[model samples]
Target: MPYADVNGMSLYFEEHGTSEDTVPPLVLLHGGFGAGEMFQPLLAAGLGEGRRVITVDLQAHGRTPDVVGRPMSMEAMADDVAGLVKELGLPAVDVLGYSLGAGTAARLAVQHPDLVHRVVLVSMPARREGWFPGVRAQMDAMHEGAADALKQSPMYELYERLAPRPEDWPVLVEKVASMNRRDYDWTEELSGVTAPVLLVFADADGISPAHMVEFYGLLGGGHKDPGWDGADRPASRLAVIPGATHYDLMFSPLLVPVVRSFL
Candidate 1:
């Protein structure tokens, strides 16, 4: 029931494990059309041990209501998170983001380097063009008219149950679609990201493996073999969850274990 007035909306958040932490809070950001509840199962499995875990419901998602006339975009969501971090008075925190939230998390780290210590980007592309052509087509196809069709999805059911204004599902769809319409390329921004990062992808993800390696390179990874002395390894790392696709990767048990080990 904790809500922070962030960027003109009531941004809802929940804390788990020890409320206070010297290890820095682990902020979990969910994919597009998902709420923080998406992470509940993993947290319930004890993923938050020894650290404070914070799950945030992004703007217009979950318990948070959409503000009139505000179109959803990566930048906007990132700014909202930055506001939330500042509002909470967290000097620095670790971030784990998936898909839409990944983009937001990356942008937050890029824009406010001092606020983010380490980052984990799951199933997210460095740039909009990193997705497969078919995935791009599907993303671009999202619209309000597709709302009824989307009802068949579990995401829609989650929305139907938890959204403050379930009747505005169509509006949410249109906003996401609108945000997808814009082109975002953060190639340069990512290369200069100061914080150490972990780029995680599924073996059969929407993003190609070639692109995943390229993303790793941007964070100073996969360029050359690290010395056996373990002195020359890049702070950044890459992880691929076998037998998982973007849709199911979030739910994969391996996902939490990898993230828990990393962060």
Candidate 2:
């Protein structure tokens, strides 16, 4: 029930775990059309055992109301996150974002390096073209009325349950669809990110394996095997969880360990 007046919006967020000094806090960003509660499984799986976990509902998602004039862009969302971090009085924090959140987190690391210590991206691609052909095609087909079209879906039900203004679901959907239509390629920005990163995705994710490898390469990974004593280890880590897809990757039992190891 906490809201932070940040970046021209009242953003909602929740905190979990004890305030332990040895472990750094983690800022969790959820996927598109989803809220902070989407991470409940991971939260229940002890992701916050030794650390503090903070989950946020981005603009127009979950308990947060839509921003009147701001179109949802990864850059603007990242700025909102940075503003929240500043408001929280944290010098820096580790960030873990999925799908839409992942892209936003990447932007955060690239644009506000001082606010992030490390980052984890799940089911996110550095470039718009990194998504598989079918996925891209599906995205291209989205229109302003998409939310009304999906009113019978479970996502709509969840939105109605959590949105500050449940009737605005259609508006949120339209804004997201509009944002998705915009072209973007953040390969250069990814290369410039100074924080160590963990790239996680499903074996059958929306991104092609080749593109995943290319993304890892840009992050200084996949060039060579780590030598003895791990001297040649890359700062970034990549994990492709078996038998998982974009929709289920976050719920995979394999996710927690991989994330913990990298963090």
**Candidate closest to the true structure, highest TM-score:** 2
Give residue 57's lDDT in candidate 2 (0 to 100).
Answer: 96
lDDT of 1 by residue, 102-175 (tens): 99899999988889999999999998888999999988887789999999999899999999889999988898
Clashes by residue pair, model 1 = none
Q: Go through the candidates in order and give each one's C-alpha lDDT.
A: 0.89, 0.91
Model 2 spans > 4 angstroms off: none
| Per-prediction TM-score | 0.97, 0.97
RMSD of 2: 1.0
* Predicted structure 1: lDDT: 0.89
**Model 2 over residues 1-263: C-alpha lDDT tens digits?**
79999977999999988766656699999998999998888989977667888999999999999999888898999999999999989989999999999999999999899999989999999998999989988888998677778888878888999998999988888888888878899998799888999999899999999989999999999888789889999899889999999998998999999998888
- The TM-score measured for candidate 2 stands at 0.97
RMSD, every candidate, angstroms? 1.2, 1.0
